[model samples]
Target: MVSQENGNQSQQTGGRFAVTLPLATLRGVGVQLGGRDILTDVTAQLRRREVTALIGLNGAGKTTLLRALLGEIPYSGEIRFDCVHGNRQQPGHIGYVPQRLRIEGNLPLTVFDLCGLSLRRWPWFLPLGTRFRERVYAMLDAVSVAHLLDTEIRVLSGGELQRVLLALALEPTPELLLLDEPAAGIDFHMQEEFYGLIGRLNRERGVTVLLVSHDLTMVSKSVGHVWCLKDGQIECEGSPHDLLHGDALARIFGSHQGVFGHRH
Candidate 1:
């Protein structure tokens, strides 16, 4: 593991984009839950306009780190956001797509209703205005799900639901995007397409992405940087080619290989 003091000094490459700025920096960040140290002396940087994959075992605190960065949980040390000029509080906007949304299968919630709940400030009883509906449609259209606008959320497939959630997250154009296993239940082909969409967004709009994933093969293809977390701290970080090949993967993952399969 890289020591906290030396973590920030590690080199970062942006792959196709040539990005070098640090979008977010974590220094000596620690998280404790139920009197147990969930994370100790964690330090890392999420490069601006780049896709970073956070990979590890199931209980390695990958989601915990994301929650800490989102300010959703209490943590020690500092998480600084350099999204805007002279602003140190937080990013101007942060788009988040969680692992899953637990909605009752019987609930009569349409895609428009789901989007409106977040996008529209008005109460659900109020009729959605024409302009608001248009904005929502356009957002869905960008993700190629506009046809599902009136479709019930419960009836949508795993991939469709993910796309809808992604659309909701993209609005207002966030400087940072946090995805916790965004493609968890989707089929492999759809997962590839989804990652492609994410990569396209990073390249086109310059959105910095911090992705938590277990699919090492997909991680290798999708992200520019990979951070392997183990026992609640970063064990290794580098490009996929540097960290995911040969003995490096075995060193980081070890007995947890069954969780995420790979040819190498």
Candidate 2:
């Protein structure tokens, strides 16, 4: 991976690493879909309790990397986890909030029904006990959306749905949280609120986050470390200031000046 060694870049001051230990490491990770390589020899580390952002142009394998970590797709390489509990071949507890949830055509499921179904494995008709409701309430309350518990999922706006999804992902307090374009389709204000919540989670709960987003401006301000994926590989990795404000993004993105925002 390329390193940003530029001297003029501002150093990240927010304890860029509370713990330098790596929570997870990916070495020579590669993924192929439909006989086409989606990721190639991607090597990177997710530091313990640090928020890392993955940024790249469309089809840059950002989401593929996240999916590979989730083990939803087969890949060629070693994904090793060395959490505080113990070393493991797979992740312990992973919370994933996808870019969007696609409900079946015109399905009329309330926020309660959606969260309740995921919280338990039984049929949808099965009675959700008071304890279950209380648990869900606490989860929603964390994201400040408990009042929308009974609202129809279909009726929710983009921001509301994303918040609801975030609440669901925080359950059981996962060790690693994977968010894909979490702020996409939401207003700027909502995006700011969402990112603030994520930062709080990292600081308070020590939940290691690996997020994939196209919003370079937000990623620059919200994350500690930023990974630039170009042509299916990690082109560079460093603090947001080092990567975003330095020449790293220019080299990784090439002529995509408007996207990087570092060039006038």
Candidate 3:
């Protein structure tokens, strides 16, 4: 629950949190790694309940910025959260899904095991309670993954795995969600479903979402604001339609020419 008067003009919520300030404000955020500047002057305000997109070419510091916000990396910046999270650690108040998760294919981990472990604080030697298992199943049902409760994590398809991760994130719904390229391996159809699910959460549940994605068309269609990063600096910040036009697309992503208007 940290409040700062500085942010984009009128980046306030019109819903339940309207009386409160913006959900978050980042100002003069800079990061350096291995003697190289990863980000400089990266500032953005995330208004409550709006789905925002973070777009950039490879190595454009999108992940680095997310890491900075999560307090996973040491960086020079000021990241202030609204009063809802000011009293606690920011990481505990936010949910995150990375670009990809790597696990051994042969591991016998089940979906139930994964979710239960997160909610449980007891030693690994202790068995999980039945009541917790039921709760995990209920969350899985929300993401249409209840049928895969006993299935091995590695055995699930790409889209299924992503949804499972999403289900896990929504259980104790946080004030904000950080999704890093959540639709990486999913096909066209699955991607649509994934985007729709995110939209529903934001609109109905009032969760603020910021996702890193390369699907320009999907960003344009689903997100209210888009932040384009280049060389560790914010190259452009505006509505999806304004920043994702023809020449801007070509300038940022040369090989994916004319892809701004097409769906991935």
Query: Model 1 over residues 103-178: C-alpha lDDT tens digits?
Result: 9989999999888898877777999899999999999998889999999999999889999999999997788899
RMSD of 3: 4.4
Error of 2 at 163 (Å): 0.8
Misplaced by over 4 Å in model 2 are 4-18, 84-92, 121-125, 260-264
lDDT of candidate 1 vs native? 0.82
How many clashes in each structure?
Answer: 0, 0, 3
Model 3 pairs whose backbones collide: 1-83, 1-85, 1-86
Native-to-model Cα distance after best TM-score fit, residue 235 in candidate 1, in Å: 1.1
Each prediction's TM-score versus the true structure: 0.88, 0.88, 0.88
Ten contiguous residues with the weakest lDDT in model 1: 3-12
Over 4 Å off, model 1:
2-18, 85-92, 261-264
lDDT of 3 at 31: 96
Candidate 3 per-residue C-alpha lDDT over 170-224 given as tens digits, one digit per residue, 9 for 90 to 100: 8688788999989887889989989999999999888989999888888999998
Q: What lDDT is reached at residue 223 by model 3?
A: 98
lDDT of candidate 2? 0.82
lDDT of 2 by residue, 26-53 (tens): 8899999999998988887777788999
